[model samples]
Target: MRNLDRRLIQVVPSRRQLEHQQLEFYSFVHFTVNTFTGKEWGDGSESPSIFNPVKFDAQQWVDAVKSAEMRGLILTCKHHDGFCLWPSKYTKHTVAYSPYKNGKGDIVKEVSDACRKAGIKFGVYLSPWDRNNPAYGSGKPYDDYFVNQLTELLTNYGEIFSVWFDGACGEGINGKKQVYDWERYYEVVRKLQPNACISVCGPDIRWCGNEAGYTRKSEWSVVPARTRETELIADKSQKEDNESFRQREISASDQDLGSREILRDETDLIWYPAEVNTSIRPGWFYHEEEDDKVRPLEELINIYLNSVGGNATFLLNIPPTKDGLFHENDVKRLKELGDFIRHAFAKNLLNDAELAVSSFMRGYGIDNVREDNYLKYFRTDDGITEAVIDITWENEQLIRYIVMKENINCSQRVESFRIEANLGEEYKTVYDGTVIGYKRIAPLTPLVTDKIRIRILDSRVAPTLSFIGVY
Candidate 1:
């Protein structure tokens, strides 16, 4: 494969760019083997007949997504286990053979139609590794089969916002390389859904180069910077590039690893604006045992703040059951999360005097606070060591407590810290703790005086501390 020349590429508004501009969010409908067999779909083999969503309501799903403030939905058209959500003309192992609706309904079509009706974007995830297809192992033929299936998806579905092709390759039945004609696939997509963003290995966006939900302090926007340097680079490279070489704008996607244990090293390789994909349940798929595993509203808010607020988009997965139904618990949690997010951030902090950030002490870091300028201060022998910020009000405004925030770029341990108001002569020690790695901090407190200052005392490692803001 030839490297994409940054020059000849016209900066197009990718799906991600559109989403960002629209303040739109996404949903990952992870329904497949995991929903049917109550097991994760990694082995790539499952009975299509087992695929049934009796209560499947594409409109309802779309309505829920819209209600949740999401702009796009990505259905798991075909998972790694190779079960097709639609009745594929290329394979018998699909919803066409399923007992759901007597195998007469096409889930992808319903979803696409529903999304269009709701004026939202539609996308699909087609796993490259087909475990059940007998020809999957036959290298040359498998490529053809894959293309055929791709054609079916692209041609059959409505205008797709994205064609999610994950890099999950495995040995076919004949034990040959799972070779894929990506160029052919791209061509098909271009012909069908010309406006769609081909994800991961495609021309537009990459996989953060990592799937971790966490985002770096400095996130790259999907809208490529139209600089003279980029243009010159692209021109030089594209001149020598071949026809097979596709030139696409840069983009990124990300998902949180659903482990309870927090990642120690918070440096996620995924680029921003990364999409944080987390499930409402313990697993990505639905299971009887996981019916009660819905994530709490507060926890979901934290995820949103850290993910989307941290300069990454949030892709919250809510899997449907085998019966093609969302669990009541899941629905409740989703509603609660939506309500909490609106109530917390949507409300003007200037009006509500209830919101405040108490401690700006060491160890605590601010994750995502909006800023108009980059505040650089206190450069160390190595680099910048610490930063202090203060916000004051002139009149008695009906404002809530002030917020002190700092963006941590690298892993560091804090020794001590203090927060002081301009009112007092001496600084008062508000919070003192240890912040381990790269993370944003948001400290809330009761409304107090407007003037506030934060100071960091010590650190084990040094990372770029972006800025402090009062929100």
Candidate 2:
């Protein structure tokens, strides 16, 4: 085990940067031994032969992710109990030994292929602790074994978007240290997926220090001005002053603390973007007994606002069952959730309003503005919409184009809309009649003007809009 040169940790298109672009949306696929026994795998002890999934439909999972507008998916290739989803040459205790379909299928491949087809990025969750493998807690030899398993995962999988490592270190066999070479792990990932973002214990980001998702309204005060590597280490003596410590490297926090409750007040100490991960059910795995415990759409929406809308990325865990398939209840709820999001912000002046830009407006394009700053104009009940935008320049210049984003809420109706420039002296009509939600109306391009204003006309009801950009 070797320590990496702290100076070599250069930031590329890291997780922080990707998050800034794709704002607050990711999927968590919790699939492992927990799905087979209807019990949580605290220590990886489940038999790999039980990994059979007869009617697994990877496409359905991908479809759910795309419909939900999620940018990435993190699969539980190996849980704490150490059961591997894909067959590994390093160990026989994997899907290769599973009883389902006589251990002949690879759940990881199915997911990766489906994600590629759906145009969604893929990531994997590999737990460092393994209660199932006797060698896991057996000291140095175990560390070597662990590295081999990781190498198998990295080399076998195609381009991974991320590799999530949880710091749930368990006791080694006979009280020996479970010492790990984190630098080696980081190097392996860099070699396999050059652009992937490592999570929690890697170079790019660190855990949120706690797994609670809820944060106070003023939590932004806790976020560090910039990420620093020094903050990644957990010092028992500095626990009280963790908030005061600042670092120069970017970091991220994860929250899956409770079943449905997010401790919103704890967000005050977050230094970087927080991630909220919760399962669709009470447990992270699919349980026949918990089949009726599907989370209601309203609860999901509340979680979305309190987490994703609260300036954090939301990681909703949708676990597949022993049959290697998402429960019907899970599927229906995902679709319902997607529809709810689509209808919440559907209609706006940006969608149908005419665009007029002043000839003097110059040096401004959609790509030039910061995403969070750009999203400030549009408002939604849950804060997910970004439908309307206003721009003012120091000098008049020619404007290129105005783009009205598609509505996330697709069920709502828009009655009418109006766009007026120069305080209503000159105006152009955008939408004059009924319009369904989720569909993009039209774009107003090459509008040459300086000052512009917009108003929703005769619209009593409107869906929540995601975004509106002016350049």
Candidate 3:
């Protein structure tokens, strides 16, 4: 594949959004007041004195994350309990009132500094619901308080890559729900960190519709355009009278775009990618009882494949223990997962193989080209639907994974595909899958073969391939 240039067919991603998608894999640090309370959702009545971590080390946390091959870290600066990690002037119920460093510790500042020093990106997750704030249910006062805290984080921190918001709103201390001013919150993020992509309850990125670590089998990065109103309305209203509307929005947001032959709402097409977020353990916060329950190495790899390999960003939550460090078991598991991935994908078997396509267009015979800029096409006399590309290897080699990529700049075309390996002069089917969007890494059983062929079974148009590889 070489010397091919074409206009993008699908909705284009913003520079920030594209960079975010390229991150592929990252960890979410869910350390908060709940870390000490042993609760998933805290009611904000707990004493700040219980939040002391004597051996806290932000550098150690970042080092562990880097060792795991993750690109960045998203610190849960605040949760539904409204306990701020930083010493915000807005609330006395923060670390300022805690015993850590005699009320002089700032978790956000330390983590951000550690990230910058370690050369990985940093992000912030501030929950919209504040159960501790007395002014929460009072519209204008609560909005002002929330915005002021947001401004403190964005302005104080160096550069935040992503800003995360959850749909978890509950009744405040007054037993009345607080109406979050999401628009104003988004406005502040844009003004402070324009390069950051807002995930969930914001306009930039959409949730994968579940907390599980995998997306739909046929996940599509492109979906129907979302309006401002739809973007601001969190899913918390599902149990209220707006249940139908919430359900519809959720359905549309996570709609599987790979199964469609023709997107009828072409005019409304938008690049709203999904983010697969899941905890490293069954719970988001660290608990001593669940120390041995860290997600096994195999499960971590599977989660990576399903999320990052399935064309979606992955946010694996790795909660810090009460000691302000990753559990020894968690650190060991992350290292093992990273090592397995690095070794498994160390080299591509098809990088230098002799390549030929069934239907070559403009004398562009695929010579094992794997770069995204140089796309190889299979355009025939009668509008090519199905085409095969044969690769001749030097000798038999072990093949475990096959990575495929469509020229997504030209749109997601291939609907289904199959790969066959020539085993002793007899070709045998090894793998079959759907939707090769930006990238699709198909893991398969190790097979020894000297030659292999890939057949595109279905496509909306003559597909343009940017890469095809075996590892």
Candidate 4:
């Protein structure tokens, strides 16, 4: 259409990105030395003896994650403090020197094996900034050390789904920040874990601009290519010497990242989707004071909708307690969340409704919307961005929620749309939305209606919608 840059609708996600998006919700296990110190960031001087989780149960962690209806778990194998959960021969400041299992336990292996047995995907997060290593801040030596640690995790883990990184660079043991060999780190991941998607500071996924559980009203997957580089650089610049782990997230929260106006002059375009990460508690690490402070059910649900249901996937961080187990309070809220979701979408109210579309591509049909085929979507003819789909049933059906999905494999073209319900004589807008990338779970007030219609108000090109649901 126009070198794939001028035409935003033609840009699509890579295979790795596509598969990653399919995992709508996942868990982020943020357990490290920080869990013991009651601090968010450790200074890398903590003793290995303080690292033991005597009652640690990896299965308990995975079980709690599964109960929440999450698809995967990304463990903080090592944090910025340079405390490796796995026993690395390269560093004495690891679980190897810890008191757990008499200095022989490997938390990484335990969690990975538990995940494999539980039939859930496992991923790793190895911080690039190793404050405990003397080689850091030294040229090639630090790069070699980073590669060595990364290779160990990839080679040992059964099937790594993602490798999460952040741009938290601080003074190393030598008092100078080490220049990360970003390309080489990505290459190591590619060579060992061919199917894994590198996230945040890597290629496949982007951080959703904030860790406060906030999401853009219209999240776009096809942003300018420079976003990947500019964001990492920004993280380093916004860092404070006292708070080595925090970054200013709201500053990057732009309202229109991939609008037609923004992409018209861009030289490059990429399918860099955002991953909305937020901790269940106020902080990423467990503190006894925050045990009663687990996120409320309603707050978690809103984040789930705005993230996994928005254009981005949700990475909810559930930090483990000092005992290395998910707190009972956290588990209770997770159960409530899972039960609410399963019971909410238990049935699609539009199942038996008659379907009719105003227009469709030559080979497609209106019936495709009712089918479970994700690829077989109902798309409007060329240049016909505005369209409609009407549904009716013999008796009034109660619908509390509406779901819409764009066939983003063809690129996210649907910009604005509304779902209307005919409560009595005329139709009324129940929900209005924008940017239905991947998935959009729109909630509505409980209403009884036998007839409903979807109106596509605008789009950059002919709109393609893969799914619609009434719940």
Tens-digit lDDT string for candidate 3 (1-471): 111101124455777877887788888998878889888778889789999988899998888888888999999998888999999999998999999999999999999999999999999999888889998788989999999999999999999999998766678999887777787898999999999999877778777776656567887766656532343446533222222332232355445553453345344666677788887887778888989888888888998888888878889889998888899898898889889878988898887677878875664446525654444543432356577988887877888998877656556667788999898789888988887776788998888888889998866546667777789
Q: TM-score for model 1?
A: 0.65
Indicate the TM-score of model 4: 0.96
Better of 2 and 3 by TM-score: 3
Q: Which regions of candidate 4 fall more than 4 Å away from where they truly are?
A: 1-6, 230-249
78-169, model 2: which lDDT tens digit per residue?
Answer: 87667788887777778888776577778888889888787888888887766666776566777777778778777776778778776656
Where's the lowest-lDDT run of ten residues in candidate 2?
1-10
Instruction: Give the range where candidate 3 is weakest over 10 consecutive residues by summed lDDT.
Output: 1-10
Candidate with the larger lDDT of 2 and 4: 4
Clashes counted in candidate 1 amount to: 20
User: lDDT of all predictions, in order shown?
Assistant: 0.56, 0.55, 0.78, 0.86
Q: TM-score for every candidate vs. truth?
A: 0.65, 0.64, 0.89, 0.96
Q: Give each model's clash number.
A: 20, 43, 0, 0
Using TM-score, rank the candidates from best to worst: 4, 3, 1, 2
Preferred candidate (lDDT higher): 2 or 3: 3
Candidate 3: stretches off by over 4 Å: 1-8, 226-233, 236-258, 265-267, 360-368, 372-386
Q: Higher-lDDT candidate among 1 and 4?
A: 4
Top TM-score hit: 4
lDDT of 4 at 40: 80
